[model samples]
Target: MAWQTYDPTIEDAYRKQLIVDDRMCFVEVIDTAGQEEYATLRDQWVREGQGFILVYSIASRATFERLEVFRQAMLKVKRQKPVFMLVGNKRDKQYEREVSTAEGAAKAREFNCQFLETSAKTSENVEHLFKTLVRLLRATKQQEQGVQGPIRSPEKEKKGRKCIIM
Candidate 1:
């Protein structure tokens, strides 16, 4: 489960399947941490993602500052704002916390996303974050379908990440 690497330039893409509420949820995780040079690749990933988990370490001030910038990039690239959640990781490292919980909540409010604090090392709220994402994705799909059956444009499906949730 620990796919993190020390190199900032290196990006990893991993897809995992889980059974959520008796249904399969295929989640594709693209770690763009320190991969700003791979903007094109990141853009493609965002385009294809049904939902996203934007993670930042509570101990890193720079990462928190860059969160909005990342959100703006996603908004600019995608026509519709995709379902996304803001996750403040490294919650176990309370001693090194640079970003306060109040600040994280405020920023998440500004970005209009579900916010959760987690400790990847301790597995705190990790499952909850993914479950929340899956729920958001399902809700979004329902809303789209309600608008006269999934407002999809096949033309936009040229090249995008595909999540196979069954």
Candidate 2:
């Protein structure tokens, strides 16, 4: 489903193939929309999820405040620091915004994740949001596989010839 036209129910699942960083990435998106009735089901999905996007509407302060609940649940279920992206949605509703961008950034800092404000309606920053999350997920996967950037010996460092595998 296209981002702009997607109308999520209590839970909706979508699969899309994206060419992120020149690599084919199969992305499965499970959107719960933070409905309280689906908390148990959301936990199950959380356990199986490799990365998470905790989203709140900039127009709704209540939604923004509830982000911690979602974050804590992800941490509790994942049992490790989870890869996350904090998103303030409905950027097209700037006039109705109750949560400031600074608040979103601060909350992302608290969660130790990347922050972005996007408008699904206008397609503002929507692509960047997903792309950034994919990049972060890719980095996290590389780290887990013990592929941490370029390894340079002292001699190589002095020679200024470091090999980086992108």
Candidate 3:
């Protein structure tokens, strides 16, 4: 959901809650436009923002170019790889489009992050962008368990669903 506020936020804040994944997803919605003075604040959020949605305006090529710098900074501060989604917003302004969908997709590929086009004014693909990131994080966490399912007695093991015999 989009929010408008007269109350200024200095640190690029976050609001999180439990979602369908049954996980408390800590997502950072970044806006680098007026953040030139918030470098220290950005670093703090980067350390805590386990997942990120790197948003750029399709209407502005400058925003698109700056996206990579923000992403690299996030990776450096976290000292590890992170879950990220690259979003090209303002798809409704087709006439003003400065960045092509293919360009966004290609940049996402370079960073190995998911990408989608969205229109905040029209609410297109916006929810999908957020949902995809949640699932990606949940799936990554589940991978550690796939290699070792819970052990069960051989006598109770089903034929096709072979149990991990202890």
Candidate 4:
């Protein structure tokens, strides 16, 4: 929000505590911007991540086109269909938009994930995006638990991991 223009991020980490659906969630965000330099390490990040957010600027078709590359990488590393949320950013720049909302929604449908457009400048849907993702993560976790038959004790609880975005 403080940047005057798009800054090419190498990697940035953020920690936030959010209350979603009456449950407290501690979310850690790792923003890599999908730079080529970090391609070698992407697999590790994907393996440690529980949820994913794929973001692209609506004003840049090039950015949108690269979403598949990232999506493929995630699928390959996870070896299963992982949770995903597709975000078309820079909604504030409608005049400069190169990607339409329909295209974004279509892409989300193809990926079988939720989709939304957001303007970081105005803070639109920013919180909603994360809250929705957390809901998805929680639901997935609960489903897995139901399949496992019973909830384990705290002493047997598995370690936690971060929620990553690219």
Best by TM-score: 4
- By lDDT, who's the top model here? 4
lDDT per residue (tens digit) for residues 80-131 in model 4: 5689999999999999999999999999999999999988677778889888
Q: Would you list the C-alpha lDDT of every candidate in the order shown? A: 0.75, 0.77, 0.68, 0.82
The C-alpha TM-scores of every prediction are: 0.83, 0.83, 0.72, 0.87
Q: For residue 161, what is the lDDT in candidate 3?
A: 26
Instruction: Give the poorly placed runs of model 2, Cα more than 4 Å off.
Output: 1-4, 147-166
Arrange candidates, best lDDT first.
Answer: 4, 2, 1, 3
RMSD of 2: 8.5
In the range 66-164, model 2's lDDT, one tens digit per residue, is 888878877888865678889999999999999999999999998888899998778788778777777887677567657565455668655642111
Show the lowest summed lDDT stretch of 10 residues, model 1: 157-166
**Per-residue accuracy of model 1 over 10-121 as CA lDDT, tens digit each:** 6666677666777766677677774668898778777766777778899999989988788878878878768878999999999999999999999889888889999867
Q: After superposition, how far is residue 1 of candidate 4 from its true place, in Å?
A: 14
What is the Å distance of residue 78 in model 1 from its true position?
A: 0.6
Evaluate model 4: give its TM-score. 0.87
Give RMSD (Å) of candidate 4 vs. truth: 3.1
lDDT of 4 at 103: 98
Ranked by TM-score, the better of candidates 3 and 4 is 4
All candidates: CA RMSD in angstroms?
A: 4.7, 8.5, 9.4, 3.1
**Model 1, residue pairs in steric clash:** 48-161
